[model samples]
Target: MLTEDFIGRVVIVLVVTVLTTFGAIHLFVTFQQETSASSLAVVTRTGTIAFMVLQLVMTVWRLPPKGTARGIESRVTSVAGTFLILVAAFLIPAVDSETVQVTALCLIFVGTVSSFFCLYWLGRSFSIMATARKLVTSGPYSIVRHPLYVCEAIFVSGVIISHFSALMVALGVLQFLLQYRRAKNEEAILRQTFPEYHAYERTTPMLIPSLSSLDWR
Candidate 1:
């Protein structure tokens, strides 16, 4: 059922997962010199639960119909999004010490707001399983073709900036690249899916929305 691209990406995902996991373990152990492993484990479990719940909700609502597989780029973006969410959720709280207190809180607040907005805007349009859904070219889509992805980047950026670690930084940059690639492919598909999408694309920026672009009518 899986295409070569998907298979290839799955391999990449596995490798990245292992590396990130190792990095996370090392990070914990290194910092465990200062903090308690039990507390960190609690943080990791809590983050995993929260992220999994959010992912479940998104998946149920936004999954595309059967046979509508998005390309490698989109899938990669999805994977990156998942990775960053777990990384931020699990590690950020653990690393939140006196030196990074303000940074961590600010990042969490901003990222949470942005991610919520993304989820709200995506509504029933957020699916990994792939299913048929109406091309959402209004509301947030009217402002930007891919508001959800923009929100995703914003979320990752907030978390990375808050933590300011090598691993988070690497993940954030990779996520941004993947999201951009995915957005491009998604826009191409959108152009075909919606009768009015070309017109919508002409008026709307991809992500950096401006007030003047809105019709407000």
Candidate 2:
């Protein structure tokens, strides 16, 4: 007898695994074609590939949710916030500015590296939807309650910059709003599961890191 939760986990793992494999193949083909690519391009591709692999592993082994946001709104916002940039990328035409491309690459690299650390700290607590597995209040979470979202925003900003257009700008704004809503949904679940989360929330910034919180030592 297979429960819905087990089936859902299996599906999620399979989907992510497939996507990561395909993305790696695409990157490999691109690298082969552009043998003279810059060092940043090479480093970004490597980091991106590593991130995908780590995500796939984490998806397979993540802890079961202690609480999940109920209602269609939570589900819709989570899914939309996660994939909006990919949708925009597929629809928009990328710009041809060398300088902007370089900047975008730098941003993507930083976002990828930052996200990897966030995910590392998150460990088995990671999920695409608003669910509470464990309260992670250390590391990057100490700086911002939703460090993952901040890193994602950085990544998405780079993607939008590469595909700079009026429509993409609009979509980027929408994406940020959706991510905010998604974070709130996650916070609701976390607070419900852990009473101490309220204290953490009071002390920590939501998306933006507070300058005053830094020790600077």
Candidate 3:
């Protein structure tokens, strides 16, 4: 016998799953609707859908209660980030997908795959806003304090470059700033919750990993 709250959670999860699946299907179908498709288009679109499915999977697993908000910063960042991502994706012209498209595809492929690495290690710990779930300090996390954000940056750089929109570039810049603040807010929570986070922070680079940041132990 499940409680109402538990049932509600299940409903929410179902709804999210449906939404993600529908969105992926919609995008894939749209790709086919195009007059012609290039390998680059196929690869990037497939990668985007793969990323979305992964997100849905992770969302279901991490359906547990999240921590209370630290402030409005994370909330704003979360909304803005989501909006920017969708806008960038749809704003991509349907045709004339040449120019830096190949390079963009490569960047997106790398970023999408790297994001999977970060998410796999993070497991059910993934969260959009700055809330302490479980601290992931191994795998990609060991490389950078915010490996997911790094991956996202790689992914979005491709979108902006391939499109080469002044507006998209501006959106990317804003997203990066929001993500930086979001990372800091998450860190504050983690540091307060887990004393060992300081040691982790000292060893790990905030965004990029290098010899100095590697915890080779």
- Give the candidate number with the greatest lDDT: 2
**Scored by CA lDDT, what does every candidate get?**
0.56, 0.75, 0.69
TM-score-better candidate, 1 vs 3: 3
Tens-place lDDT digits, model 1, residues 1-217: 8864345445544645564565556446645564454344334333334434565555544544423445555666655655654555455444445445344444445555666676776777665422235666666667777766665555555455545677777767776776676666666666666667788778888888788667522
| TM-score, structure 1 vs. true | 0.66
Q: What is the lDDT of residue 135 in candidate 2?
A: 92
- Model 2 regions lying over 4 Å from their true place: 17-53, 215-217
Q: Give the TM-score of each candidate.
A: 0.66, 0.82, 0.80
The numbered model that scores best in TM-score is: 2
In candidate 1, which residue ranges exceed 4 Å CA deviation? 1-52, 63-73, 88-96, 129-132, 214-217
Order the candidate numbers by TM-score, best to worst. 2, 3, 1
The predicted structure with the larger TM-score, 2 or 3, is 2
The per-residue C-alpha lDDT of model 3 at residue 117 equals 81
